[model samples]
Target: MSAAPALASLQALFARAVVAGEDEAVLAHLAGDPETARRRLGLYRRAILANQAGALRAAFPVVARLVGEGFFDEAARRYGEASPPARADLNRHGESFPAFLSGYPHAASMPWLADVARLEWAAHESLMAADEAPLDFDALARVEAAGQPCLRFRLHPSLRLVRSAWPVLAIWEANQPGRDGTPDREEGADDVLAWREAGRLRYALLAPREAAFVEALARGETLAEAAGEGEPWDFGTMLGRLAGAGLLCAFSRGAAAPP
Candidate 1:
């Protein structure tokens, strides 16, 4: 193999050894004695797992608090072993943690825990999403009335929707530091709207119809189709509400769907 490919293969093997705790394959490639290499690999494995757990803890503080430190640590370790980080950006790690919690034996008792984790991930993603300039109303006004129906509206890059059978938004809010850990009512559904506003993360509960409208637009539906999703509701008012909230980022007069 060429130097580049040889180095790449070695790096991949090293990552697998550290992440999967299978260092034997990598021992032969190291410079030192096998025992010393094993010792160094063990240290690397511990440090990698610790860093991954720290990243998970940072990303899912609400989940960590709900499960307590000891439980969270064990769970984080198992999670790291099961789904090792595929990217260097640790901030983007643990996106699958909510799904992991759903099937986790210990977490089954707390059925709502997974959804809460999902909401937290949404909040994290919203905060990390790239910023975009708000929609240009003048450009929108220039489109003729006949061409408006097919116009595709672009919501803000940070906008995210999380639908849960449990009142996850309330649960998340109640668990905030210094707040009483009691949600208003625990038995109902919540469709949360998470987004970044003025550099701060914000979340709110969305009405069912409003969610449908937004979701349709998110799927690259045209104005006519999205407006139809909320029948009997004034599309103008709905559009105005989203635009006023700085949620509408841009628009395009074409049939192509959003990338």
Candidate 2:
């Protein structure tokens, strides 16, 4: 075989060994006479495993604390092996971990664990989402009443809405530091909206109607149509809340005139 193909095959074999948790097999594949090659490969595997574990642990510190260090490490190792990082960005590494935990056998006992992870992931995503200018309240105030019907409101780039069957917000709060009271797993369902405001991640529980309105708008519904879908979707209340939370980015006074 050509040198290139031979080297590629060797690299693939090494990768498989690392992924399969077969360190001995990997050591055997290195140059038989060069003891240093086996040592170096082993070191490389250790470093890679450590890096992967650290990235996941950082993203899910609350989950790690909930599951205990040992259990969390084993679970993270298995997940890392199954779904190795495909991108260079470490911040995006644990995006699928919540879903994975939901189906994992060990986590089956903690039914709320997955939802907690999901909440944390949403917060993390909101913090990293693209930044945008806040809505121009002054300009909006100046728009004529005749142009109001044609106006289209825009949402902030950092805004995110998540609705969960479980009380994810309560679960998240229960896990937060300095929470003096006992954790209440049965706190109830939640509809949460998160966004980056003033360079900090901020979130609040949304009412059913408010959640519906925001979700509808996210799907490109005009304000009027979006409001129609929810309970009186009090435009004044929704706009005030969103604007206060920095969720409104910009808005156009009128829809694009037909070409």
Candidate 3:
């Protein structure tokens, strides 16, 4: 085999050894004592899995709390085995954990568990999103009235919307540390908004009309279309709230795009 291909093959085998616990194939390529190499590979495998599990634990603390640490650890191990890290940064791992839990037979009893995980993931993403300057309301006011309807808006980069058939917001709040793990009312749907502000994570349940309006905007709908989603509702008040909370980041007229 060519030198480059042979080296790439060796690297792939080593990765499988450490990530998939497949040691036998890679053992033949080792230069040192076979037994020693096997032992070292085993140690590396365990460390990699441990680091992955730690990342999952940090990102899904509420999930860890819902399912005890023992169960969470096993689940994290299975997740790593099935879908090993594709990137070096552990912080970006476990994005599909909520989907994994959805089909997890052991968690069938708690159908809403996946939704809660989704909420947590949204919060994690929001916290990691890039910072942005707040919307320029003065520039917006100067736009001619004729151009208002065609104006598209940009929500904060840190904003995330989560909708679930279960009362996920209530469940997430109830599970917070030192709080009793009981939701005030547990039998309804929830539309939630999670975002980061001033270096802190904040989330709240959004009213139905408000959720629809914000969602329309997030989809890049113009102001007129977004307003239509919440007809008869006071959009001026809603816009004010968004600005006050640092949610609206920018806007554009017609085909012009926000930076």
> Each candidate's lDDT (Cα)?
0.85, 0.76, 0.87
Q: Write the per-residue lDDT of candidate 3 for residues 124-195, one digit (tens) a residue.
A: 999999999897789988999999889888899999989999999888888899987888896879999999
The list of candidate 2 runs beyond 4 A from truth reads 1-5, 22-40, 146-150, 229-233, 253-259
Instruction: Supply candidate 3's per-residue lDDT for 14.
Output: 91
* Regions more than 4 Å wrong, model 1: 1-41, 142-148, 229-231, 257-259
Q: Provide TM-scores for the models.
A: 0.83, 0.84, 0.89
**Residue pairs in candidate 2 whose N, alpha carbon or C atoms collide under 3 angstroms:** none
Using lDDT, give the best candidate's number.
Answer: 3
lDDT (10s digit) by residue, model 2, range 101-187: 999999998887887788788888888888887777898789888866555667887788878888888767776777733567676
How badly does each model clash, as a count of residue pairs?
A: 0, 0, 0
Model 1, 98-201: lDDT tens digits are: 99999999998999999999999999999989898788899899999999989898899899999898989888988889977888777778999888899999
Count steric clashes of candidate 3: 0
